[model samples]
Target: KSVGLNQVILRYASDKHERIYGMGEQYSSLEHKGKRIPIITAEQGIGRGKQPVTFAFNRVFMGSGGNWHTTYTAIPHYVTSAARSVFLTNYSYAEFDFTDDETISILSTTPTNTLCGQIIGARSIPETVAAYTEYSGRMEPLPEWAYANGVILGMTGGSAKVRKVASMLRDAGVPLAGLWLQDWGGIRNTSIGIERVWWNWELDESNYPDWHALREEAAMNGTRLLTYTNPFLMDARGPKGRLYREAKEAGYMVQTVAGGVYRLGHEPGVSFGLLDLTNPAAVRWIEDVLHDMLKNTGAVGWMADFGEYLPFDCVLHSGEAPIAVHNRYPEDWAALNRRAMIRAGLGSKNEGGNGEGMFYSRSASSQTPRHTPLMWLGDQLVSWDAHDGMKSAVLGMLQGGLSGLALSHSDIGGYTATPGRHRTRELLMRWMELSALSDVVFRTHQGNRPLHNAQPWDTPELLDHLRDFARLHRALAPYRAELMRESSLTGMPLTRPLFMHYPHDVVASRVATQFLVGRDILAAPVMDRKTSRVHVYLPPGDTWLDVWTTQQAPAQPTGPRHGHGVWLTVDAPMGWPAVFIR
Candidate 1:
């Protein structure tokens, strides 16, 4: 059941009795009485921390990580068998080899511990994967308007500044869908709970004069308001401090052995206490607070940020093993938030609520697609490199089984450090073109820094491009919603890596620079700065039709030209990414 830190392989009696589940939608089941199947394993990347779990009979593979971050673990693909059931787990860094005779072998960068997975009987491989998807919980369909383009004005000046930008974006004819207010609601220029902390949760009247009015205006314009709330609760004076104390006393918060509550790195050394999601009372308390916000302010939802930093030195109320539970914390956190939304009748029935509930979270764990509807790639710089990085980030996330990604719009006009009005315009135009195709597109700039200010008026031309892209995004709302619903139902990724459709193609496995938006469109983003051209690989079977030019490329006959194949070529700049549909 447990492997060491280095590569090790063990053979056990092929279990004919155990039932299996959780390999996502690619494999067949063991109960199919007709045929015998081969299970093969392969090693792809090492140390990037992706571990895959496979069910041999169903051909379904689930991936997990060795560390604390969630969203890294995913169900990749699957295969099927009739006589016996098999599964593979590459925990840390490892290689899995499947023999023609159905023998499973594994090689690892470090020794890994694996679970003895169960075997199940199903009619077919796809059915097996579907069963797993159902058991893990299906993905939630995002709101129709979520697909439209919007701006995430970073935590800059104050409420006045945010409202001003919103007004201008609308006036400029930008078809904005939402406004993302980051960290502004938590503390108002200070860290959470450092001084007079309890009051921090309430509106900072000085900065947010007439906050209710602002929310009303935003909603009237078809824009939803999203704010950031981190897990860190600072130990401070007044009701804020008292809330933490009560939560802790009621066993609603996580406790550290060092006798100090957990704290996230923020200005003025702001510290935060962790809520123990395992405790039902804690869940209720958190729900009540959020309910109040929604009922009073008409706020839409929260950007549930930062559950990735749980300390190994802390304790959970459920008495679960910390190391085993660390990476699972995000799942618990998301579930708690989702539960709150449901209890307040603000979310979907699947999430145990009524309305269209959405939570944009940072970290995630297994079955995240079932709970958290949207996730932005974690913070990155606002520059060309950041722009290029978004493609890779998207590939990684999709390969890891995410439904959709919200790469911060900061890269469009460049982050705070790089300064040039013209350069900002070009970058924003290029970035917007690609962002328009994503599930949740929002523009944001880094705040608290001189160079990263993302005020829309900073560059007029960039503003024009922003408006154009926002409109394009709004037009794509129908398609985006459909995709979200499909991903939720099928466990298929919105942004797919080449390997998902072309698993048998060798070239496809290595093509990380490009990915598919859905089954039809393929995007190869320009990753290099100042470079106007790059190579693109197309999977073998289908001829590709360029999305922009409607040009088609003939497929080669050397291998499969259907299902999964690979082809490669170079493309020239077109002010946007090279998109092709077949």
Candidate 2:
């Protein structure tokens, strides 16, 4: 029913006992049985919900630290325990109200009367996922370098700093494939986290004077230079605003009601300028800019950063309703980058062919998988909090698996860093273990404030811990490659829930802390601080061997596949998170 000229509500019957999952990298939990989830894309606030950090940040920092319902990749899609899958077409602001056990409602603001969606039905969970992805979009096979690269580390500041870190890590025998420098253009430290970046996309000869030289040197050592990008461009209000000026003069930026350039505020230029993707000339201009920058700078990949901040009150060149086109903005951003990849000669040759070009996205919705080469669990707090930390990364990957984002991963040590919520020595150790076991693109972030966090180069012990886990990741590259290959063909996620493989086992449905890396391997990463052991549930009908110890499963483990399997307590030390292989 229509609430007003631009508001509507749609309700559906709900299953009281069926647990809900999948809404693009949500951190609260994997099962959203009785929670309200919003499908609006924006920064995943500092500490979600009414947590300690959130409560303080909201009052002090103007509520910038988002609540539990806030997320980066907010997709209006979900799958239930009963195998019911659904996807909504709205791109703008929307909310899924599951608080009511008997009835679920979808409330959205739209200029039109109708909304589009699909209710998928299949015989089994696997088939249901396959059909859902086939209808939405299948992910492209990851580039060969993704499997071979032991880890992709984020080293920021400038060329000099990057070289120093590289020399330290290489001397310590740590493996690295790509160095993602988010401040490639320059660094701009603001009062909060989001504005700690310079917006210009081109090479800032001042910030990176010898950028190409560093790229060449890295290439000689079998490494690649990567950078970051997003749809919005910040105006420094000075010569650093060259790109913004060009975009504005060409009438390529999103405008206001009076047809003036909107500088993310009331025209005083305190924020960034939103690039108008609806304009063909603007898209072409950005494409050329991306191609020239990468081709000239020798950057192989980039973190295609944000796409979730399209405000509904803006005027676009296409004249489409801004609210209606909000949710799909991130998908558009990914597709734009994919096209840029091809233009820059970094794209793969054939359908399943391998190439060095890769871009990892944290925000996604609608048809993003077809364009997003990789998915990284978005901004997680540096602490061990379940609402938004190491544990949330696991839930994000598993949720993406069921929702068709088949190749999701996360930052090894986490990104978001506040005063009290920064990274610690033990957190880094356990995080590396979890990352190595996943065997995807193992990577790390320097947090929002690099100097405050505990880094790998902090001590020799941390370096040795990094060296060991990176080697483990590299050693398992071949197996990870096989999983990626299977994902490309069948649309099954590399990070699967236990129930996807052991449907008959009742315990598999309830195991949320652990995840399956494809069908052959299982991992139960210790997500707690100062914790070493994890109680694992070995599903029935499989010969499970502890990956660390090579110990066989208990007797009668091959019992019927229908009941709750045996709960085994295994020793998981600092360097070893529980992992089992079939």
Candidate 3:
């Protein structure tokens, strides 16, 4: 049988029964057992639940006494079955088939010799999946400093201005851990009258004078620098241009349907193409550039941006189909960076091992948890609405199996509207409290607006408060480091959703506005102005202890502690979010 979209063919010998299980939630057992289940190969947005496809074996159509079966459960190990199995070679696309009693053969419209005649055994499925995860690479632990309060200077100011701000933060007694330098560090220099040979990522020494000394000063003050780098290479420019040409020659860059290098639409100035990480040589070329940046600039890590621009019209170096590889590119991108770090001996598992590597990615895949240790919610509005949206984003990532997240700093003092010093202070304090528990706590504000500045010194009182909060973040680094280790080893999230704790609680599923920091601390950040109190859902069982006053609230089946259901009122004067521990 030939496989097409949302369909597959399975060939089986006569006289054999197949059983299968575990494709997400099942309405009925027969839905995914002993049948050939239809699978859709497509791209899904973040927070969207698993691929929109089902698998079961109970439903099967037989031809000439040959039976086909579908199973949701991928076997624990590779087992040679009497059934012949065929699937989309790409794992990101759904795989729906079962191995029982007969040899099952799967056919795809885009069949590759690599997948033809491959025999799978039932006993090795789980190990195979686990090995695949390991093969992709395990998640790396973030640096200790990443957990502390950080200042993300928008592109509004030049490098000198950023240095001055860093100096001011230090003078204010703020224990800053990192400085996020935006696009000012580099500019694309084009050869005169030549369209090709554009040089991006070249340091602007004139603007950033004494760059080495600046990095050293920050390092001495216990702060590191994180600069931004985009994957989009300028059309025919510099090393990237050369690399692109080389890759195209070697067939290592993705190609379009017309046999042209894929062009990224957002960056129209240059014809952009993605490097195929499946190609070892392509990975090596990218790694060399990363290593050179670290060795020369004293930079710590990268703020990997723009991975969301993966076009559906590109092909992989491994000859895999384009549609299935779009979302999976970020995983491969992060993996390439991690492997580079490991190759540099920075991530060697040695005593006092300096394995500090992470990426601020905008896209993800199923095995993203194994690559990106630190990911932030995608671009969001700078408004109170964003405050509520942040909760949903965090919970969504947690449920989707991400290990760590950075709630945008706009939740703090920065807003797109007119600035209110008092209100901004309140927001900043509350946001700081919540951010202190995150894997990365970096402050950022919107750009291009005079009134939307998030500089810590917006007010003398606010500056003092910011300093205090920054110090608290530094003090919590030891505890945060322990949690980071735990998150790396276990599949637990730093910020957890309610379902993680109360899987069966119907009420918890609807409550995405709040979450637990680790397993003990619960946080509810106010997302609206003039809202003094908010309702919190408590799962049945343990009583919770208030973080501020250490007051105990008795667990009840329903009703409010004061006036609302398990409500925690914010003391506006103190300006802190309601936090509790169970």
List the global CA lDDT of all models. 0.51, 0.79, 0.48
Query: How much is 375 displaced in model 3, in angstroms?
Result: 1.8
- Sorted on TM-score, highest at the top, how do the candidates line up? 2, 1, 3
Q: What is the lDDT of residue 546 in candidate 3?
A: 74
Candidate numbers sorted by lDDT from highest down: 2, 1, 3
Off by over 4 Å in 1: 1-131, 149-156, 184-200, 238-242, 248-251, 258-268, 349-354, 383-388, 402-429, 440-457, 558-574
Candidate 2 structure quality by residue, lDDT tens digits, 229-286: 8877767677678888888889888888888787674223356788888889998888
- TM-scores of the candidates are 0.73, 0.93, 0.69
Report the lDDT tens digits of candidate 3 across residue range 1-582: 533444334455523433232221111221133444333211112112211111111122111111122111111111111222222334333334443445544443332222322333323322322333332334445665666545443432446777777777777777676666654345443322111212244455666777788788878877777666655555565444665666677766667777867765423354566666667787777777666666667666666654545555666667666545554566677666656556555553642337554446545544555556566544322333322123433443443332122122222443333223223445555555555544245555432242344445666666676676566556666656665566555534456555455533445534656777667777776656556676666665568887678888887553223222344454433345667788
- As a whole number from 0 to 100, the lDDT of residue 93 in candidate 3 is 35
Superposed model 3: Cα runs more than 4 Å off: 1-140, 148-156, 184-199, 236-252, 267-271, 348-353, 386-389, 402-430, 443-453, 556-574
Over 191-283, each residue of candidate 1 has an lDDT whose tens digit, in order, gives 321112222344445556677787788788887776556555556676557666666667677777665445543345546677776667777
Model 3 scores a C-alpha lDDT of 0.48
**What C-alpha RMSD separates each model from the true structure?**
9.6, 2.8, 11.3
Q: State how far residue 427 of model 2 sits from its true place (Å).
A: 0.7
